[model samples]
Target: MTARAPQFCSMAWAGRPVAIEHQWIEAGPSNGPLLVFLHEGLGSVSMWRDFPSRLCERLGWQGLVYSRPGYGQSTPRPLDEPLPPDFLERQALEVLPALLQALGVDGTRRPLWLLGHSDGGSIALIHAAHHTDSVAGLVVLAPHIMVEDVSVASIAQAREAYQTTDLRERLARHHRDPDSAFWGWNDVWLSPAFRDWSIEAMLPALTCPVLAVQGQDDEYGTLQQVFGIAAAAPHTTVEVFASCGHSPHKDQTERLLDLVTTFTGASSPNHANI
Candidate 1:
């Protein structure tokens, strides 16, 4: 099924307010569990295609999908400006919480689940680590705990593709300003200071149940990412998909859905109150 048309909500960023593009995949019960989806570095609500809806329908739950400040139809970051090394940190520490509040998501009222991909997965880890009381569970796909040489190399290739190929045009279909989305993410991941960026230190702080998934053939990150999460957060359940690439949801959708459904179903009785 196609995702619903997106809505917008405003929040402060870098001392200035920006609009965030969001959509609600409201399925199942009226008071069912809520699963929030965090898109990848260059991803947005539209970029997620119909996966969010499919997951929600299969699980008989609801979902929220959004694009961060610079992606999709949301506010566009200045093309000339580059993101800070701590941009992902800010998204976790600041942007996400604010967006949640703005959208009236009260975890106390119902269980809150986070499903993230790539950079989004990192942000989910950071958020869950700090806001342990808020998040019910996590499903992180190809998350990064520490920078990998492979990740940097792939991102560099993406940069070249953006400049020399039709990547920009392709991305424009999903983003109002593809440059804003691509450069904001690409610049930071490739920066020298970002090479040392790692959330391994923060994983130990996670108190919620976590389902960490990685593809055996993921070009961006290795299995060590999930292994690292499992090591730090012993409560984490790790799954490695064999024929998958960076996106198991796209590459191995049915398998991923089955794993996530089982993981979330066991985490809370409210997984599907309906």
Candidate 2:
């Protein structure tokens, strides 16, 4: 089966019901474990292009792909609204669980693996740590365990580029409110307090196998990101690809996909969770 049209999952958040946009890729074994694809900071479901479909089809596993609030066709962020400093934490600790429940994804009833990129990867790590019983394993790409100066600089550059270039217009095609996605991600990363943000403490709590992959030439972060994860989480594996940039799925699709497919299949609960 191929990917189905987008669907919505509604749940209460901040005292109001919120709808998250999601799609199902029904290409694989109906009984196979689920692979949830979490996109990067600036990414939406459409920004992922056909990568999710290709990966799920090849692995023969059902997949769920979604765009968080203020991104893609989901609810747009209000212009005057500001995202909280613990936005990523909230997304992992609260939003994700609510979304899973709204979609009837109970980890106790089925195996669940998360494939997250960039910010999504960090969120996955946090979620895996807090909900070990629900997560089977994780394949995180370019995850940030700690804030870096390079990250701030790159985001600052993006801010400048947005004003001088056509970045906003291009992103508009993907996000309902491009400003919402851009500012929500940029402002938080560049904030002074955000410099001290780190998820290293959460790593030790993750008991499942973690395959942390990052590009050798990633500008947004460094090897420290994945290496830190490996050092913190004993079951973590690190992979740094050369001649690649930040987005491994886009920079090195074939190799990344192969590594993830094999990793997920190998991480049986009997092996990783043990």
lDDT of 2 by residue, 105-208 (tens): 87766778889999999999999999999788899999998999898899999999999999999999999889999999998899887889998988899988
Residue 199 in model 2: shift from native, Å? 0.9
TM-score of 1: 0.96
- TM-score, every prediction: 0.96, 0.96
Provide the lowest-lDDT 10-residue window in model 1: 265-274
For candidate 2, the TM-score is 0.96
In candidate 1, how many clashes are counted? 0
Candidate 2 at residue 243, lDDT? Answer: 94
**CA displacement after TM-score superposition, residue 173 of candidate 2 (Å):** 1.0
lDDT of 1 by residue, 1-274 (tens): 4356799998887889999999988786646688899999999998898889999988888889999999999999998889998888899999999999998887766778899999999999999999877788899999988999999999999999999999999999999999899988998999999999989889999988999999999999889999999999999999999989999999999999898888888887353222
